[model samples]
Structures are given as structure tokens and as C-alpha cells.
Target: MLQIDCPWCGPRDETEFSYGGEAHIVRPSDPDATSDEAWADYLFMRTNPRGRHAEQWCHAHGCRRWFNVVRDTVSYRIEAVYRIGGQGPGGSHDPA
Candidate 1:
């Protein structure tokens, strides 16, 4: 089982969280104007990085607020987790 470090709750089992996918993905300004490719990209595209990866996740069983987690996808090791506004171990980004 994967272990994740919750910034507010400390290390917890992965079952307590929900994967929110890639962290930095931004939606188009105008969804109506989005093309088929753009829509497809938004719906299906994802960055499956091998090493360090920034991803959005929800501490479902803890704080209801969403947060970012920087972890190694290969080893399933967590690097850090932080709230949306607070400074994390690395950097912060607007929540998706």
C-alpha cells in the first residue's frame, strides 16, 4: 500500500485520500470555444512522470480541503504535501 504525507495530518495510508490527477492542469477560459482536441486534452491527457510528480489529491478522511502532493510515481514514496495557499516543501500552484 502507498503511504502519503498529508501536510496537515502527517503520514497516512493512501486509502484516506483520493487521487486528483496532475497538479498544474489549467482549464480553458472559454469552454464553449474549446476545440475537440482541447476538450479531449482536458478530459484524457495527463503527465505520467516517472520520478518526482506534482499531483492534486484530497485528504478525504481528514481535512476536506484539496492539497498538492509531490511524490515519486515509481517508488510510491511521498515527498511533501501542502495546502493550497501555504508554502509547501517545493512550490505551490492554484488548485485545479
Candidate 2:
């Protein structure tokens, strides 16, 4: 099983958390002005990056707070954890 390090609750089972998809994903404000393709792209598209990746996760069974995590997709190893309002060792936010 994969072990995820929670910033607030320490390392725990992967089942204790829920993946929140790619981090730094900002929803468009002007949905009416955006095309259908744009909306579909935003809703369905995601980058499944290898190596170290910054992602958003919710501590479902722990503190129940949403935070960011840097993990290796290939090895399922976590490098660091950080709160939403703080900076992680891999830097603050993911690419926009």
C-alpha cells in the first residue's frame, strides 16, 4: 500500500485521503463567454505527470483539511507536504 504523508496528521494510509486531481486548476469565471471546447477541456483534461508532481488532496479520515502534496507517480513515494496557505519544499503552487 502507498503511504501518504499528511502535513497535519503525518504519514498515513493512502485510503485515508482522496485525490483532488491536478493542483493549480483554476475554473474559468466567464463560462458564458467560453466556448464548449474550453469548458470540456477544463472539466475533463489532466496531466498525469511522472516523477515528482504537486497535487491537491483531502485528508478524508484525518484532519479533513485540504492540502498539497509532492509525490512520485512512478514509485508512489511522497517527498513533502504543505498546507494550502503555505509553501512546500518543492515550492508553493503548481504551474497554472
Q: What is each predicted model's overall lDDT from 0 to 1?
A: 0.81, 0.83
Best of the candidates, lDDT: 2
**What tens digits encode model 1's per-residue C-alpha lDDT throughout 1-96?**
888777787888889999988886778889999999998999899988889998889989998668888888888788877776556565556644
For each candidate, what TM-score against the reference? 0.77, 0.79
Measured over all alpha carbons after superposition, the RMSD of each candidate to the real structure, in angstroms, is 2.5, 2.6
Residues 8-94 of candidate 2: C-alpha lDDT, one tens digit per residue? 788899999999977767687899998999999899988888787778999999999898888889988888788776777745664
- Which ten contiguous residues of candidate 1 have the minimum total lDDT? 87-96
* Whole-model lDDT, model 1: 0.81
